[model samples]
Target chain A: MFEGLYSALEQSEVITLYRHINPDCDALGSQWGLATWLKHRFPLKRVIVLGHQKMTNGLFPDSDEIDDETVRQSLAIVLDTANVRRIDDERWQSARQIIHLDHHPQIEHFADLEYVIDHYAATCEILAEFFSTVDQEPLEADVAEYLYRGLLTDTLSFKTSNTTEHTLAMASYLAQSGLNIPQINRDLFDVPLKEYEFASAIRAEAQILDEHLMISVIDQAFLDRWSMTASQAKDQVYQFGGIREIEIWAVFAKDHDDQRNTWWAGSLRSKTLPVNDIAMNYRGGGHKNAAGCKCLDDASLNALIADLRRRLKENQA
Target chain B: MFEGLYSALEQSEVITLYRHINPDCDALGSQWGLATWLKHRFPLKRVIVLGHQKMTNGLFPDSDEIDDETVRQSLAIVLDTANVRRIDDERWQSARQIIHLDHHPQIEHFADLEYVIDHYAATCEILAEFFSTVDQEPLEADVAEYLYRGLLTDTLSFKTSNTTEHTLAMASYLAQSGLNIPQINRDLFDVPLKEYEFASAIRAEAQILDEHLMISVIDQAFLDRWSMTASQAKDQVYQFGGIREIEIWAVFAKDHDDQRNTWWAGSLRSKTLPVNDIAMNYRGGGHKNAAGCKCLDDASLNALIADLRRRLKENQA
Candidate 1:
């Protein structure tokens, strides 16, 4: 399936890379891993990676400030992005040809050459598999390190459900290329001091309702108290997710829409129950176990809680 | 090193497995994994796994009720045990010959034949490597699942410092033999409702000291309220270790020794600082990052806290 892309890589003199907006380790890793491999294999070819936002520290190299003309001259390769609109660079459309490499469910047939493996944990896994099929010598230490980070972070260090024997095999294959596993783990996971303290505060404020539901609301008051944004406060939702007694959990935050209408945005999670149905019912959606939704005001938030409680009672019964 | 052990496995008609006391996933995994592999390969040979206590759910099988006569006829293998006193079954000494496989710093020489690799993350890694070298056919799915659990849990799903490329390679090899990585992870890590609630309660009561250290005390009254023992409370120390602002953290629980001596037993942890020195200054010892100790009274506990504060101040300076 990637034979065309392989041939394209061999034929192309210049390549440009694009990942999803607000790129994660998987997106950056796949983008960089592919670029490193291509550059090492074809030393004469030009490879440019472009993105708008950055995560954490600038551990990976910065995205190139390439012009539209440059993008028009190069073969644009987008990695780890599912939706067409989610691509960071609008200039990706100006490229001579487009190749999409992803591990997300295919929502759009945007690329001229597409390779999507939804079963694989990360785009890096797909890229690694493809790299393995081509020349093995080009998959150097640096390339392996980047790909491994993507795989590790995407799977939450192989704790996710999608992680399989193939995931471990791919990880092992990359490990064989010689990389510091411990350092990589640290660089990707070690949190800053303020973030850690903030997490402690979130944990302290978590409320266990009805002996089954764990809810933490980071409303305006919480934001004011912590001097953080709603999004920043909501990111600590994971702190409440792992609680044993809580069969269901939610993190609600106060936010406003573009029209300046007040709303309560919340992320819902469950261990076994289907919360996506509830999320969908509330004009939002996600997977079976994890989901999210938004309500117009406090009354709707109360109603949603009541609905969740009723669902919990029904679930227990 | 395992050449003699391979010969023993081939020649012996009976085999017995021993793990460390208060056995964790790594100990049980190695024991069951080796037993399962041996039983599958050498059908005629009888194999038994022995342990005094079990972890959370009796997910691992129980120790057999065998007499000293049966033990005397078997080749004993102790897995993931550092010291002879820590071995669950005292009957191991009665075996025809003994083999010790561990990944802890050697504290005692008890087994007739010992293979200890401190650099490896888990004993399962050593056993898996040995199994790989001996006969590939014996490394069945059941064996792989058990070994993978040990590898995963001991390394905290490859978050530990000792988790090397060999550890991951061993895990990958086991994974390739056909095992559910997600299920294994859940079985080993996913806490029950009660445990999760207890963890939340602990987190709620956590205190930040000296602006850098996070401390949680599960005193006698708190234990009585929660209906938990000191050991059960101490286990939650890992929950605090990963938080960012905390350079050092400690969990202190009030308890009494066998002699009715009132004391506060506690575990100490540091993310980057040298905490073992402070632990050693008191009546405790551990690695550079993690250690344990006991204090006679409240004064000693306060003294320990002051020492830790001073250490933290010194560390920062």
Candidate 2:
């Protein structure tokens, strides 16, 4: 199954890797893991990782810069990205050849060779299997650590629904490199003390509307106190997750326009309910269990809550 | 390695399992995983799990009650307990034979046939390997789930320092039973809403003493508001963990003696520093990184902080 990818790597004199914009650990980890392996195997070949944004935590190194002439001579390999529009570097279009490897449902056929296996929990899981099959030697510690980061985070330390025996097996395969698993976990998941305080404050302030619903609103004052952006505050929705009494939770952060009109953008999550329909009513949408929305006013926010409560009641019925 | 264990199980007509008192998932998981397998293999044999205290979260069923005569006729298998003193029940002494399985360092030579491999991440990991080698058929879903819980929690979902390739391999072996991995994770780790709120409160109230030390004191007023015991409040020390700037963190909870005098018992943790020595000065002791202590008065509490601060400064120097 990886023969094409292996052959493409073997034939390419130069390779440039790209992942989606707003790259997460999975995107960067998979891209770096593959790039590290290619550079190790073919030391003479030029290998580059190209992206515009840095990982928010600053754990990973900044992306490499190369001119269009260099891109035209390189083989482009996209990792953990499904759609062309989301790719961080559009220079892939100028590359001599393009390959895409992802664990998301295929959104486009942009790559000459696309390996999209939605069943895999992370792109790193697929890459781990591919590397193990093609190489007899154990993976280098760096390569394994890079891939392990993606696998660990993408599955939320192997708790996500898509995690499988293959996921653990791939993790086991990576562990053979003797990377420090505990330290990697600490590096990847540890929050700054300020962030920890912010998370706790969010949870402490959360309102449990019912046995099944919990919500938190980070108005302009709260965000200003934390020195966080609306999106950053919205990310704290996870603080409300895994509560036995909470079937659905949402976090709304107040934002303002240049003219000073205020609105609220929110992130919504559920354990076993479809929230996208409700999010759609508020001009946003996402997966069944996790979605995003915007409420233009207090009345709209109340309506969204009513819609969510009704959905919960309907499901129970 | 498991031949002795298998033969012992085959020879016994009645078996009773015991684990450490105040059992965590590992103790209960290994005990029940072995008991479930034994019962499935030998339906006529009496398989019982003996303990007094219940799992705090109530995820596992209550322990069984058996008579002394039943114990005298049974083969006792002590699990996850390195010392006899810590066993939940004392009836093991009356059993015809005693076998011990644990992943903790040997604390005593009390059991007749002891199987202690402290190198293994969890007792469940060892049991998973034993079950696989002894039985050709895959484990039942229930048996697998039972073991998975212990392995997952003991290793902190395979992020502990002892977690290795073998641990992941054992987890993969159990996954073959087709248990719902995500559901088991949720069941084992998800906290109640109140507990979540309590954890957040702990973090929100924590004080950062220095670059390396953070602490939270849950005073009587705080405990009264939260409706929590001193020990329960101290358990929230985990909320301070994984902060990048902090090397050592402690949680002190106020407790009252019969004389109506208040004292503070605290849990101390560090990323790399040895804290047990400092704990020893304060009438407590534990592992290098995690320890416990008590301060009889405010002066002693101040003294403990001064000692910890000096230790951090000395380490830095």
Candidate 3:
């Protein structure tokens, strides 16, 4: 994983980390994990993470706020990033040197030095291996905590096909670092009562798609009536019952308050159909198991549905 | 929502229903929404729920199971159950009548009359208007959908101390439907994920109560490391970033694999010491903000933790 990191570290004076936009747990987890490790390891160089906007992480931590001056003078290390468009901040062009570390399936790398490990479960897992390999010093509990967070998210609590033995070993290594498991479990999963109810409500709306699949949606009225914010509605979409190979789920919701913005968000969770490819039609992407995209309006949505049906039929064939 | 409900609509011949355990979501959403309506409206006395486990039903529609002989001779009704424990198996008890319905929370309410409304905001909101008044049927898509699954959980989807005017309005009208919203939301909202995570690993691990009402668990590590099942250890817990509020947030987790299991489950969610009242001592009860008991281990875990310094201070003075 540290193929060129040693040379980059030696040659670079400043480093800024980057991850995919919307800042999922793994992205931010790996970004922050690396920053914390580097900040302590390379006390001589300035280190920072760039581009974090948590549609889900409200007041959680690591704001999207970036320092214009930092990127201009530092080396940029992108974590868990797949595409350039999703870069939370676009100011990394000014970086003196760039390093990329990720676990998404092979996508074109953008940085000067790319360390992509798609076979691993999470970016955090990769970072954990990197941290232990560098062997500069022991990791703090909090740092281990963040790395573990990334590992957990990408693995879907270890339920995803992307996970491997290497991932668990890295997690075990992190656990050995004196990290507190219960504390992270609570913060990471502690859904508010409202969120639970929201989940229940939408789960109530779930309708079995194919015999093996279930799908549901939260219309604007439903969201308004429940007093749900955007993220809550987004989360509640996954509460359908019975997860099987045939389980294909979708949630179509109007984005925000703008009527003109008929943005629909869906979660495709199954080994059956690669929903990510469907998501690619629009300006969205993720792992083959889980991906997303946006649609402009009704016409596009219908066309997308037809295309999805045809592709699904082809898969069945 | 239920335009063609229990009436002499040619003797429903066979009907079954279900609800969340500990009875919440205006229990009637399943018990009353279908059972009573069917008893008064449909014919063919074959009616019953599916199971017979015991739990709190939040009191929306209480148990409505029947006997084996009755299954051969009459109709049955299963009320306010989100799980298999409260199924009116008398239907199966009799084999002639079978039906089920419910606002499936995180917990699955497996049943025959399984018309689960997991997407609506509340079960009671989907029932009538208030706790006691059963007339009229759900009509508007919003109200129908909202009440279709409203008020079956504790967070009350805007109920509790954190409720709003619209929440009450929707609930009040639903209450006027001769169904109860309070009991439904209350019962359904028994143990949230965060509380479970906290109670399981965080609070049990440590009970330090300082003067400023401070109680800190070992941050995110415990959560990240703990597993729900032997199979799930490979899967890490929730993965997210910034790792905020670790210094001081309530924690809980469950000894059982299912987070929804009530008997030996744990809970911990609060900002200050006031949470102790809910985390009570006797009869396994306490105030609203906090409360916990042994969900499933069959041991007096509460008493065990009661001796711990932080909680020991709860009943003192």
CA RMSD per model (angstroms): 2.9, 1.8, 21.0
Best by TM-score: 2
lDDT of 1 by residue, A1-317 (tens): 67898999989988999999989999999999999998888999999989988866666988778778888999999888888899998889889999988999999988899898999999999988888888646368999999999999988899777787678778877877767776688788777767766777776677888998988877777777777766777677776665556788888888776796778888888877888888887878999988888764788888888888999999778
- What is model 1's native contact fraction? 0.59
User: lDDT winner among the candidates?
Assistant: 2
- In DockQ, how does model 3 score against the reference complex? 0.02
Please list the residue runs of candidate 2 whose C-alpha ends up more than 4 Å from where it truly belongs after superposition.
A257-261, B257-261
Question: In model 3, what is the error at residue A180, expressed in angstroms?
Answer: 1.2
lDDT of 2 by residue, B112-193 (tens): 8988999999999999999999878879988999999999999888888889999998988898899798789889878887
The DockQ-based CAPRI class assigned to model 3 is: incorrect
lDDT score for residue A230 of model 3: 47
Global CA lDDT computed for model 1: 0.84
lDDT of 3 by residue, B79-171 (tens): 445555555342444544443444445375333444355544445543443322334553333333234344424232332332222334454
In the range B54-161, model 1's lDDT, one tens digit per residue, is: 776666887777888999999999889988889998999999999888999999898888899999899999999999899746378888888898888888888777
Measured on C-alpha atoms, candidate 3 has an lDDT of 0.53
Candidate 3 regions with alpha-carbon error over 4 angstroms: A1-3, A52-70, A136-138, A229-232, A241-246, A256-265, A274-317, B1-317
Superposed on the true interface residues, model 1 gives a C-alpha RMSD in angstroms of 2.5
Q: Give the alpha carbon lDDT tens digit for every residue of A149-168 in model 2.
A: 99999989988888888999
lDDT of candidate 1 at residue A103, scale 0 to 100: 94
Candidate 2: residue pairs that collide: none
